[model samples]
Target chain A: MTAALAARDLVVGYRRGRRARTVVLDGVSLTLAPGQFACLIGPNGSGKSTLLRTCSGLQPPLHGELLLAGKDLRRLTRLDVARRVAAVLTDRHDTGRLTGRDLVGLGRYPYTGWFGRLEGDDDRVVAGALEAVAATHLAHRVVAELSDGERQRVMIARALAQQPSLLILDEPAAFLDVTARVELVALLRELTREHGLAVVLATHDLELALRSADTVWVLDAEHRLATGLPEDIAAGGALGRAFPTGSWAFDPVEWRFVFCGTVRGVATVAGDSLHATLARRILEREGFVVNPPDVGPGVQLAIEVLEPPHAAPTVIARHAGGVETHRALQPLADLARRVAADARPGETPR
Target chain B: MLTEERVAAHPEPAPRASVDGQAPARGRAALVFPLLGLLLVVVFVLGIAVGSVPIPVVDVVKVLTGHEPHGVYHAIVFDIRLPRSITGVLVGAALGVAGLQLQTLFRNPLADPFVLGVSAGASLGVALVVLAGASSEATFLAGLGGLGDVGIAGAGTLGAAAVMVAVLFAARRVRSTITILVVGLMVSYLVASLVTVLIASADGPRIQQFLAWEAGSFRAITWSQLHVLVPVLLVGLLAAAAGVKQLNALLLGERYAATMGVDVRRTRFVTIGTAALLAGVATAFCGPIGFLGIAIPHLARAALGSSDHRLLVPASMLLGGTVALAADIIAQLPGADFVLPLNAVTALLGAPIVIWVVLSSRNAGTLGA
Candidate 1:
């Protein structure tokens, strides 16, 4: 099947004047197939938004060809592009006294008559779009009265009402809280599968993108676009390098960036997966250099997490001085403090 | 996740309706438009009846329907009051709708043709003609009855269109609404100073005529003048009606409107053009009437509780006509011998309403929202 959207050797930029130009991203190529959920992740000013705008045909590409379902973007009228690709930008418009349904109805602009009168079929489509986003109840409520998350959902419904083949959003989850962000991304993922839409969203949400997206487009500082499966990108270290972790390292296993601190002392953690990872996190936070089980010579300290089914796990810590065991994790903090004191004599452990 | 499944399973109980009962509020809001229409009819008749002559309502109706009432009463009702009242309604409706369009286009609550210097431009055009010895030609044209009104209306329309074009040019350069607003205010001051200079250089009788015109009244619109005013106002209104969808789309901001397939530049041009014509024609006939354009849209929104242009455009027309008639009635003062300046009466009525709307919308925190 042909891709829903394709950019070939695209160079996006703005012309400054008669002769001068500012290039944002150059020599970029990507394709989005139907039913695929792709996320564009990059740091600030890395041209992610510019690329999304270019792909949506909101701005003309300075160089190269953009195709929408194998049709040249340049040949298509704005209405033609609008019919096939819907976009939700980050601009917050104050639609005074407009109901949610009215806003969502605007998505049908290209399909409606000259005066934009909504037929019965158009109303049904708008309702369906609202239903898809679980915002049917908000249909009659004033759009300005809605919360940020609710408004975002309404905007998504508006995009969906267009019934486009591809949907592009720029920082849709920027203003949402953690749970709202997760729910929004999950909702987009579900819509992509159910509606067979090629959904591309530019987001600062790395963790959500890594966890939920089918494919990830990582734009690095050098203007290189790397496309791969989310897991492949994470495993290949492209995602990490694209984001550039300064004080932290991407933990592929945890699917998050973990803080990397200076090594205070060496220790070995031995336990099941859950408890071992938790212990490692706690020790690492305290500046202890934790090693994988049986991987390194951790001469000073050894910690064992004992997990018995249906009971609280017990932590046992061994040091040069003695062995300390506790039923609760709070005791592990105390043990870490003691170890720190022992490691550096006459130094207070805070 | 499970939340999605739960929502799908229990679709009957939509969650938002529980917080706010949307249906009843919407139903109550629906009654406001008809109520405003009824109020307009009452004010329209009152405007025709309660003029300087104090014709009884029955006699006013008789003369309006071509009954041979007393000859003097017939002349007052048919010749004097009817034309003035009609002019009031048309001018009111024109300014009201123009104000609404200006507000939406600029996304500024304080936007209006008068405030944006379009009306001032119209005044400057009339001043140029009346004070610059073109008065003899204008008077000669006035002798030709309706033809004179058309010439003045033409001049006013051209002037207003010129200012609108300048504003549109400035709008392209300035991204901030507040900056554009300040620019419009500067334009108004510039035009006002020029008009002042023209007045200072004019003779006494010309200054008196200009002052009366500046004072603003519907009395100037003779029956013959309506021929020019009505068609111009209607064309402007039709243009505005045709662009209702674009106007509503524009409420979402220009980029989103474009994404919705609206040609932003063309819509802007058409909208500003329509507003200028309406305001300029009204100014030409009524001598730069103020307050109705700025105040009436807010009143309409406050009544209907929606910015949906489909309803707002008509609601504004009715409410604007009503307010203008009411202002004219107060200016005439019916039974009293002395008539207040139409401009002063409108300012008195409009300034309070505008201040009230500003304070209330501000308190409600819906100004920008």
Candidate 2:
């Protein structure tokens, strides 16, 4: 089967003045199948948005060819393209006091007659679109009165009403809260699988993209487009290569990237104690999931937790003073502290 | 039925489908409204013909059927009442269609030709002609003189053109619909102030004529003027008819319109220019008749149960013309000899309908506080 959308060696740009122009994408190529949900991810100014716009035919490519359903984009009329591709842009415009149902029904304009009289099928399409996006209850509510998440869902519903084979969204999750974003991603996943819609969305939420998308299109600083499986891109350190200077690094173990400095406080505790357990738990909750052991002079954890919600047991000692605390192992110290604490405790602590 | 089953992925199609097919069965559905409008036209014509002089309905029919009637009867039907009634129809349809287009284009129920400053432009144009020495008598004679000299009507068209240009420019520069409306109001205010200054500075006779013209009258329109107006109004109505599809596309935003294969920029150009031409020409000749444009579309929508302009435009034109003719008959009815400014008569009907629309909006009612 032919790809629903394909762009070959495309360059995209916008005119700044009568003559001057700024180019955002250069020689990029990509293809999306009917049932694939693809995500375009990059740092700001990396031109992911520009590429998506070009592919959707909202913005013309400065060079190269775009094909939709086996027809060249340039050869297709505006109305013909509209019947095939749909989009949900980032900017929200208030169309006065229109109902959500009215807004969605507008998506059927291309198919409706000159008078825009709603035939039976038009109403059915609009209703199904509303149901698909879970915005049926909001059908009668004025569009301007909807919440951001609700409004976003309404926009999706409107796009669905077009009954286009391909749907492109620009940051559909941008205004949504965490839970809404997750639900929206899951919704996109389900929509692709059920309807076989070729979906392309641009978002900064990398975790969601990694979790949901069938393919990831990464835009490098040089404007090169790279398309592959999410895991392959993560493994290649393309994110670090794309964004070089930040505190960004690929965490091979977790299969993701983190963008923060490495934490630096060390503690040593007695073997078989609770403080070591409590310290590890606190650090993990704080996004510091890595714990590496050292051969020379680091702390060793030996701890246990009691009943529910109670602090665990641990041992800690200072090397110079040979100080050791028992019954309540507060903080952990280095290897030298364990030797000194062993002398202080005199209990042959492991 | 097979096609129906194939398209059944859509929910809730059955009710709408039945509604679409059963329009004829519904009480006072689309056909009834148009037929009623035709009946009103007939009644209005007879109302205009039968007067204090009490011309027989048969004489009125004979006079309208273009046969030679008795001396005074012919003079009354053709010379006096016919011109007035036709003028009412022309102005009413023009204002009504213009109003509907404006309201739909702005997506605001309150939008009308007068509120959008088109009428102000016409008023300014008329004020310039009268205060500038082409008085109403001069205007009437100019009509008699083969429309050679520039007068109130011509000035009105020029004024409307200026307003249309300003509003269109603002629409291009400012993307927000509300901002465009505020700009239109501001432009109208400035033009009104200029008209006021002209009135204050005018000499006595010119001031009296200007004031009278502002009151708005249909009696001044002669048969010769109707010849010019009928063709212009027809052309404008035809132009608006071509734009029904474009207007439907515009019910959504320009972006969506463009996405749906509508040439947004081109639609805006054609829709605004043609609507402005219709409104401006009608206002110029008819002395800025009020309310028909704003209210007639609503009445048509109520009658037809649809907002699609293909039906709404023709419905509005016919309905508005009928209402205007009826209103003219009522304006002439109170006394045998006396007459009223057509604007006052129209406002009595137009204002309440507008208020009803604003009040009917559940949101606007709450926001009114």
Candidate 3:
């Protein structure tokens, strides 16, 4: 089957003058298949939006060919391109007096005749698109009256109404709250799976992207594009380098980037599952270097997570002086801080 | 959230029974257009009947239906009132639709035909002809009978088109609608100063002619002039109607409109061109009539409660006609022999509505939504 969208050695950039071109991202070759949800993650100005615009045919690629549904993007008519690839941008419009359903009905432009009368089937398609986004209740509400999340869903529904095989969005979660962000990504994922859509969204919400996206497209600081499954990308370490920070590291096991501060001291964390993960997170956040489970030797301080049957999870810290047990992480953290402050240099107590 | 779960369970056909509730609002909105149409008819009749001569509605009807009302009633009803009322309807519709297009194109509530300097450009065109044409050689140039009227109309269209092109060019560079509005104001100021200069240098009778034209009136459009004005207005209105799809797409910003397969640049050009034609032709026949161009679109939107151009365009036309005829009726000062300036009547009726729309939209946060 033909890929929904493919780019070959695509170099995206802006032309400043007749002979001057500033390249943003180069040598980007990627394919998104139907029923796949991909996310583009990068730091600010890492060319995520430039890449999206190039792929959506809003701007021409500086070099290389972009294909939509196995046909050259340059060869497709504007209407044909619109029919194949629909994009939802982040522009806040003051659509005076337009209802949500009316906004979504605009997506029928590519199919409707010159007068843009919504035929019976067009109305059905618009309703289905609204339904797909779970925004049926908002259809009658004025677009300006809707909250940011509701408006975003209506925009996505507008794109969906195009009945395009490929959908692109720029920063779909930029203004949404945590729950709305999660719901939006979840809705996109559902649409991709149910409708065989190739969905590509550029988002700064790394956790949402890592958890929900089927394929991750990581654009690193050096302008390199890496594409793979979320797990594969996390394991391959490109996710870390994409958002390069000395304080944060990609935790492949958790499939999220966690703040791994400088090595304050090596402390062994002992336990399993959720408790162990929570304890490690607290320790790491407090500037303690956590030792792996199997590597037990040469660790002066140790902490264990204990889940009692009828109480809150407990944390037990074993140090050179003695062992301290606490029901909460804050007190345990305080204990670790005191130990780090007390232990003298070159004093290895076993 | 429950909707999400239900949608996930049955993705094929999510029930849309909730959409049925909007049917009543839609039905109510559907009634607005026809009501506006009826309002236009009533106002048009009022414009014809309530003139300087107190012709009763019965006599006005008789004269309109070709029954000869003996004496000056025939001349007043057919020659003067009929053409003037029709001109009011056409001019009002043209300015109203033009204002709607300008407002949507700039995405600014403050945008209108006069606000954008198109009317000022038209005024400048007429000023140049009326003021500078006082020279003997220029008088020979203006002595070409009907060609002189065409010349003024052509010059007015060219001037409006010129300002429209400049504004469109500036709009390409500026993203903020407020900045574009300021640019339009500056253009209007510059044109006003130029008209002032022309008035200062011209002779006494010429200055009087220019001043009377500047005051604006619907009385000057003879049947011969209406021949030119009506067809131009119709063509401009037709162009605007055909562009309903593009205008609707533009409710979302330019980028989304482009993604929806609307050629943004072409749509911008055509829309401004049509708006210019409408405002210019109206300014050519009547003077630079104000208020209707800026206020009618808002009235249409408020009445219909939708920005759907399919409804708003026609609604604006009918409402614009009604408002214009009503203003013309007041300008005639029906009970007395004195006349009022048409521009004064329009501003008196329109400025309050403009202020209300601005304050309400600002309070609703719909200005930046």
lDDT of 2 by residue, A1-350 (tens): 88889888877999665878888887778889888999988888888777777777777777898998778999988777887788887775544445677678778877888666668678777777777787877776767678888988888888877777788898878778998888888888877887777898899887778768999888778776778898887777676666666444656456555534433223332233344555444433222322445423443232232332465343433434455544442343233334333432222111
Docking class of 1: acceptable
Model 2 whole-model lDDT (C-alpha atoms): 0.71
Better of 1 and 3 by DockQ: 3
Give TM per candidate.
0.86, 0.75, 0.89
Number of the top lDDT candidate: 3
Candidate 1, B1-369: lDDT as tens digits: 112333344445444543343454456557876788788878877888886557677766677777866656887777887888888888899999999998898887778877667888887876766666544655643333233545556666666777878977876666455566788789999999999998988888767766777888888678787887888889998898888888888887887887777777777767777887788778866788888888888887777777778778988898888888898899877456788888898899889987886786744225532
Stretches of candidate 2 off by over 4 Å are: A42-49, A90-105, A116-163, A173-183, A219-226, A236-259, A262-292, A295-350, B1-74, B114-118, B134-150, B162-197, B295-311, B322-340, B344-369
Q: Give the TM-score of candidate 1.
A: 0.86
Ranking by TM-score: 3, 1, 2
What is the lDDT, from 0 to 100, of the residue B157 in candidate 1?
Answer: 66
Model 1 regions more than 4 Å off: A17-19, A273-276, A292-350, B1-34, B126-158, B171-182, B193-211, B334-336, B362-369
Residue A159 error, candidate 2, Å? 3.4
Q: Rank the candidates by lDDT, best first.
A: 3, 1, 2
Candidate 1 C-alpha error for residue B291, in Å:
2.7
